[model samples]
Target: MSARPEAADQSRGSAFRGEGLRKIYRTGETEVEALRGVDLDVAQGEMLVLLGPSGSGKSTLLNIVGGLDRPTEGRLFYRETELTGMKEDEMTRFRRQNVGFIFQFYNLIPSLTAEENVQLVTDIAADPMDAREALEMVGLGDRAHHYPAQLSGGEQQRVAVARAVAKRPGVLLCDEPTGALDSQTGIRVLETLVRANRELGTTVIIITHNVGIGAVADRVFHFLDGQIARIEKNDHPIQPVEITW
Candidate 1:
């Protein structure tokens, strides 16, 4: 949807780098290869999108890069630190300190108000922003006192985004973040993600099935059968408002 700009200074250091990354799951006699020798580099402050159908390895790759899953074989680096070699506890710390995740489901605690839901994260994060401040960043300042059920679907999703960004993590990983919303509502989520990326200087990586959504990404990785089929670079990615909803 957009052409890639030429390399910039930020490109000199990658936010994430993976080489020969592979993930395999064996249940009983069956073995499933979730990722197959995947390799990628995500630049700092760039918006990267993963586009593929279900079971196409998009989530698998995202998980490995986010420290949620380890590659059965291969190396993963966050900047200069090798993630694949980190132990469970070490990986946990890495995730807590550097990664923020948003999923398709809101995952907000229904019993908690929007601000409280965000507070859950701020409490554990090493350098978290105020929960209300996070909500305000997503334009949900007034809704901070509302619970999940009291908010609309879009508002709930915005709360989720606020929660994720509250930690001020170095990278934000989203898996089908807009999958549960209509196009217009989805655009609002995209706008929030873009704001986080641009203003926070966080590397934003998203996985989505909607082709049009890729228009807002600086680069898109097209996945097929556990591997990246191709990558599209966009020098001038359009704003979320410009997408056909």
Candidate 2:
């Protein structure tokens, strides 16, 4: 594993700021609380890892921060714009313009080739990288014409990463991005993410159950029972290849 030098201007601004964040879901007669008062500040160009077991509220918080869901209570700000009070259309626009999401499932269109899948996003973005360029960033320049079914698990995930980043979003939110892959494949995905953060200066927040993955992050947040239990900062973040399950 290798360590990259920290960005000299990484601490210049805030990417996200949240205060008293909360989420609640009610189905029939049951009420479930997914997040409980999460207050967080993610610096621009920093890599943050959220570690917790199932039902720990990390995923819920990620969803809200990424503009996929609304918080039941609390305020969230992307830079200086408040997200908590935005309408559905406003949130949609915010997500489209500022956030990139990567999930455990690849979510690639089966009928679209690798480059075409990435093009789908770039087509709508105001300022996007060329689809081929995005694929090249993830080491998939040669697989541009391949369909999802023709790619390996890791390759498919890389294609998904290319699609998410083609728009050059300011923030990248990942939810258990390597949950379905083997250790070696997972490491490859992590390497791609690290490279993206370093080169594009995107603020990244990742949710994972694997503790070893935390070593690559600038800060690791431990979640327990719907709240942040603690946060640990790594002065010298390592590479994904050094992480062990």
Candidate 3:
């Protein structure tokens, strides 16, 4: 049966949709199931928090959604494009044009300045802001010339943020982005992410074990034992800085 018009419209408003998503791994005789028939949708311009314990398949699902990993079964769609069965080159192109990834550890080159690092991506992007402008968006304008080793962990991460957003991707996937920093520093990184979503209209998905971080997200998904146990929507998400660690 066809869904109600309003329901269909609501689904269309989402940037990503996953239906019956599953992933399994086999090593020798041992088999491991990372995800089992999980379904999810993330709205456009929404900041979603993925909260889960270790080995809950949160990372696996995030990777698949970002096209970093291929799924064992099921499907993932970005707007109208089916991402599940695309070729490797196609996926690479899709990722370059549509997705931005932020990892827990800021993988910055120690020899390169922040602007230089950001410039690398801007050069490849179809339409990109100046490296200085990208740094300014993350509240790191003055640190543009600083090398990764000379900056604090938070500052380094912010540089990573600038690099990711410089490309102006449709979706931002952050995997434990603030894991390496102290509480205060972590807030700064989170604030940058929030700002990126609000100013640039990027759909941001943050995967973290910190439940406290959910207050800033428009929606939160709690993953338990490789499945989504609960989904919560916040009408008014608090600012990242206002929520204590």
lDDT of 2: 0.90
Candidate order (lDDT): 2, 1, 3
The TM-score measured for candidate 2 stands at 0.94
Residues forming the 10-long window of minimal summed lDDT in candidate 3? 1-10
Give each model's whole-structure lDDT: 0.89, 0.90, 0.88
In terms of lDDT, the poorest run of 10 residues in model 2 is 1-10
**Candidate 2 residue lDDT tens string, 126-239:** 899999999999999999999999999999999999999999999999999999999999999999999989999998899998999999999988888888888888999999
Candidate 3, residue 112: Cα displacement in angstroms equals 0.7
Question: Model 1: how far is 92 from its true place, Å?
Answer: 0.8
Inter-residue clash pairs, candidate 1: 3-234, 3-235, 4-234, 4-235, 5-235
Candidate 3, residues 141-205, lDDT tens digits: the string is 99888899899888999999999999999999999998888999999999999998999999999
* Best lDDT among the predictions, by candidate number: 2
Residue pairs in clash, model 3: none
Model 2 has a clash total of 0
